[model samples]
Target: MLFRSLKPLLAGEQHLQLIWLALGSVPVVEFAAHANPDALVLDLQHGLWERTTLEAAIGAVGMHVPVIARCAENSHGAISQALDAGAASVLVPLVETAEDARRAISAGRYPPTGKRSAGGVRPLRAGLEAMRAADRDVAIGLMIETVEGVENVEAIAATAGVDYLFIGTGDLALSRGTSDSEVIGRDCERIVRAAAANGLPCGIFTANARAVRQAFESGCRMAVSANDIDLVKEGFLAARKATFEC
Candidate 1:
């Protein structure tokens, strides 16, 4: 197994991940990509990212990091494109059933098992052995955000090729008509148990001190912190406020 596999082995595993907007000068993205973190993910669901900007950002960060992409959806084209872009793994959003999780895995794997088209200059040119290792180790993370997703967490976790069952707490709360934190924590317990049982890793998003502790205690080895925009905005506001007060 790869070094990235360490995230899933320990109970209450905690990883500090930074989520990037997938565009712009991408200073923050580059910083986090090179940071001494276990893993990081590029968010492409929002319109904030475009292919050109994504290319530039990825180039700036280089390919030394354990980088993964959260595709717009579970579409094969999107997943395949992300892999070509040099993502070591793909996080498929809104996975609600076993089939949904299965499709995401298929999109990540090569032919003979999946329909993913052969491409990507990076992987193709990186040597056949490297590519094969990547294919074997490429993580397929599924976002369980819907009520159906929560309900089928066990089944989805048990699916082959499914590596991480990432609980999208924000959406999970909204779907279940509960507070974000409350719903996330409640559902996290179930998802974590399911993941532990299936010998898979569980992922979660951490915001504050409380959430960080909760996620770790809940068995989420891989955790994503706040996004780039939010962090920048918060940093700017803090600096501006301090200057004005002085």
Candidate 2:
């Protein structure tokens, strides 16, 4: 629970952070949290994960750090289930318009505001007050990956209840037909400015440490660095290199 208390403050301002899970498994996610990366993202969107395993993973990260899950879609039921199961926050992906952003937020929040159902168990049962506190401080990051999303960046950023507008650079670059371009720097800057203009935090995903730092300087407040398979692959590759050299 070293970084458990820091989540509340993340909601208060545009702060810098590193999200260490994109293709991570439960054990991998837990390990990263223990190592004290700023945060972790349980990617239900683009991974082979069962709901039960996902719940277990969330439990593992519970109270240790802010665990934000990326949902399969902006499915209200899935959002509600994740929240009730104790996810500190949700990141909805491929949001292409303000309406998409609105729906995603609606799925996460409760009534008078939105329609997240009331159900509690496991991690949620142990710390109701604190969980509510975390929800109040929850970071609902929306992924702006598509060309349509980039075009609608302003509108999406303007949507109420969107805490962070994450620039999914890989997908965005692919959509723009310039995945290899140095123009990414300029493109990201544009999106960052859009997020800033709407008073929302800006986030990005990059494996390259240099690019992560560059994103921070370029106004990206949050970033996803590495995931399970890739992290392990890199480590093994480095180890093999070191062993051969030695």
Candidate 3:
């Protein structure tokens, strides 16, 4: 499976540069795949993705690059749907407690490990062996964004079956009622430490390449470098400015 390539990043041996896709376009997804990012995240939370597009996008790019679905919520249905759509991993947002972590993790596994029902075109086509492989290879990530989440980071990290802990810095800043970098940095550091102590890789949502570098330096193995929509806008603005200036 293409997702097997991601094992190194998950194992903390290499840094992962994830490109966030919010536009729900297969062409865009394919373009991102050609660019060869470590992973492409289909943002179902804030992105424009319905079931059909999500499945299509995954189908188009899943063979070349691993597609990670950032589920809109931390629920069994949401997690299962993403996996059903052929997402190599599922990122559950707003996870606030150890129970929340467990719930998200459970939604991605099979019986005895999770409650994920056997369905979805990809899994069905792949057959029983694929189902077993999905149970073992499908990565589950929990976002630590709320104040309660930061407070309980250690326990959340300790939760069994958790593949990685991701820090949503934007929401976390709002939860704390302060955008102070130092304060958020402290919380991020704490989360990273907890993940490391538990022998799991940590990931962070970063705004740019510099932030991604900073995140890696702080012990996070994965970082979202940028989203497709923002990159589009930036490209247009830069082109306009360059044309006018010239």
User: By lDDT, who's the top model here?
Assistant: 3
Which candidate ranks first by TM-score, i.e. highest? 3
State each model's CA lDDT, in order.
Answer: 0.73, 0.74, 0.88
Candidates sorted on lDDT, descending:
3, 2, 1
Best-first order by TM-score? 3, 1, 2
**Model 1: per-residue Cα lDDT over 1-246, one tens digit each:** 221432233234445454545444467777776555566577888637677666555556545566667889999999988777777677899999999988988888987888888777667777667776767767778888888998998999999988777778778878998886565677778888998899877778666657666676666776765556677788999999999999
Error of 2 at 90 (Å): 0.6
lDDT tens string, model 2, 131-245?
Answer: 4555565567888887888888888888888887778888888888887656766677778989889877788887777877877887888876666767779899999999999
Could you tell me how far off, in angstroms, the CA of residue 36 lies in candidate 2 after the best superposition?
A: 1.1
Q: Write the per-residue lDDT of candidate 3 for residues 1-246, one digit (tens) a residue.
A: 524334446875888999999998889998888888999989999999999999888888887787788999999999999998888899999999999998998888999778999998878888887788767878888899989999999999999999888999989999999999999999999999999999999999988989999999999999988789989999999999999999
Clash counts for the predictions, in order = 1, 0, 0
Candidate 2, after superposition: displacement of residue 157 in Å? 0.9
Q: Which ten residues in a row have the lowest lDDT in candidate 2?
A: 1-10
TM-score of each: 0.87, 0.87, 0.96
**Candidate 1, lDDT over the whole model:** 0.73
Off by over 4 Å in 1: 1-24, 127-130
What TM-score does structure 1 among the candidates reach?
0.87
